[model samples]
Target: MRKILHVDMDAFYASVEQRDDPSLRGRPVVVAWRGARSVVCAASYEARVFGVRSAMPAVRAERLCPDAVFVPPDFTRYKAVSRQVRAIFLRHTDLVEPLSLDEAYLDVTEPKIPSPSATATAQAIRAQIREETALTASAGVAPNKFIAKIASDWNKPDGMFVVRPSQVEAFLTPLPVAKIPGVGKVMEKKLAELGVATVGDLRAFSAEELQLRFGTFGRRLHLRARGIDERPVQPDQPVQSISAEDTFERDLQLYEFEGDIRRLAEKTWLATRRTQRVGRTVVLKLKTAQFRILTRSFTPEVPPASLEELTSIALSLRDRIDLPPSTRYRLVGVGVSGFRERGEADGQGSLFDDGERSPDSTGRPESL
Candidate 1:
């Protein structure tokens, strides 16, 4: 059995805020955007007591915890701290897959640490994080990734939980079916109506019965019910797509959103330029005032010929939408997908594909 551990920082953004500001420590701290339409990014445990949570609307968060100290998200500092945490993980094992800036999954089946035990490795990593970064992380160590991810949440801030190979089944049973990933509130209600509210209940049904009802996903549900995830920990996974989006401070009509779309497309284009690959598809995304999301994509015979062409294509996609002309939108996004490495393309030009003058790709004499 492979030994896996999931490390999750306790309210990462809020904790970083509290750590940087001594006065904020031990107080109800909420890290979120300070705008009417903004949503909470993270909430400290003290703030959570008032029902404040990440992704809750900022207005709602304020109503829940009137006395809460709000701090806007600073991704730059968070990334610096995240690097430090990742460095700590590397000491125990090189097989680390970062889920986000604040959480990661480590496969320490062959630990680099002197201690030969996964539990001991987890403790060491957690202690190092607390001591080095002044932030606590909860860790779950188990025989597989799925179990380890769930086990990590069993404890709160600055805690650890372990599920040994012998205890996997017993630990999984009796837990609500909702605990399984991908089983949202709607799916939970459906399962409840069928008299299956727990993982144990799911286990009582055959895989064939589930597949017949839920199609391909039903087989997945059956496997998840048995705690039978066989996925391996992957490091340095390739970026499949790149996109940037913004939620407006105030809703605007469809015709009033061209500027934001172009700006967002420019941002997305700049981001894509950093990659060695180019995407063949341009996707235009819009979120309506009622929170309905719609997307339109145009995949030309080749990648966008130029940045001007890209921006124009995205704006033109807006005209293809069948929504009411007076319909308002709260969010807009621009993205590119269907990536292909530049090295694999035949006569495909570099970053600026407009047949324009290219940057220096000449011979380099000095070190990189």
Candidate 2:
């Protein structure tokens, strides 16, 4: 059995805000724009008491808690703090897989400091995060990712829980089926109609039965319901794609195409800098006011070598949308994918280099 640990920063964005601002401490705070269309990005525990939650419309959040303070998200600062947290994880083990800016899974079967057990290692990491960043993290230690993930969320805000191999089944039974990953509101409703509201109920279904009903995902659901997840912890997972999207403060006319494209391209470039990988394809995504989605993609002879090139391609793709100039867009996004290292091509070279030769033959330097 592998020793897996899930570390989740508690209300990460809200905690960061509270850590930086003394006055915001212990108050109901919602991180979001105070607008009708804007949704909450994060909410402090104090705000959660008033039914405020991430993704709740700001207007509804205000109705729930009239005095709730609203603050815009600062992803840059959050990302910096995330780096510090990741460094803390690295001090213990290299088998760390980041799920997002604030949560990650660590396979610490062989920790750097052998004195502490896996459970203790999780505690130490969480403690170090609190001491160094002045933020709290909840940790879950278990034999596998499925249980470890659930354990992390069992107790929130500076808490730690462990699921021993022997106790996995008992621990999973009776838990709501909705707790299982990928079982969203729709799935939950469907399960409810079938009286499968809990993990125990799901366990009663055979893999064949689940597969017949839900397709391939049903088999996954059956396995997960039985507290089994065989997926291994993958470190330094390859970046399949890099994209940046923005929910505008206000929907803007598509006629404002140039400005939106430029802004989105800059955002994408900034996001890609973190990976330092060259991409062969560029994708542009747009969401119209009517909630319709449009996408355009391009693969060039030479992938964008600079942000300027990326911006030019993204802007050019924007013109291909069939929407009228008067149409309004609620969101805009730019992305680059099909990453490749120099000298790495398909068949003769790296897989990503298939049919495309690098401008320079010398291999690209490995990123840190």
Candidate 1 per-residue lDDT over residues 13-77, each given as its tens digit: 89999999999999999998777888788899999999997766788899999999989889888
lDDT tens string, model 2, 1-368? 79999999999899999999999999999999778667788899999999887766688899999999898999889888999999999999998988888898999999987846888999889889989999999999999998999999989978999999899989989899988987876778888888898999999999998999999889999999888898898888787678777767778887575787788788888877777566778888777665556668787777777999999888887667776778998777788887877556523212221121121111111221
Off by over 4 Å in 1: 290-305, 312-327, 343-368
| TM-scores of all predicted structures | 0.86, 0.77
Off by over 4 Å in 2: 252-329, 337-368
Which pairs clash in model 2? Answer: 344-350, 345-349, 345-350
**lDDT, candidates in the order shown:** 0.84, 0.82
lDDT value, residue 227 of candidate 2: 86
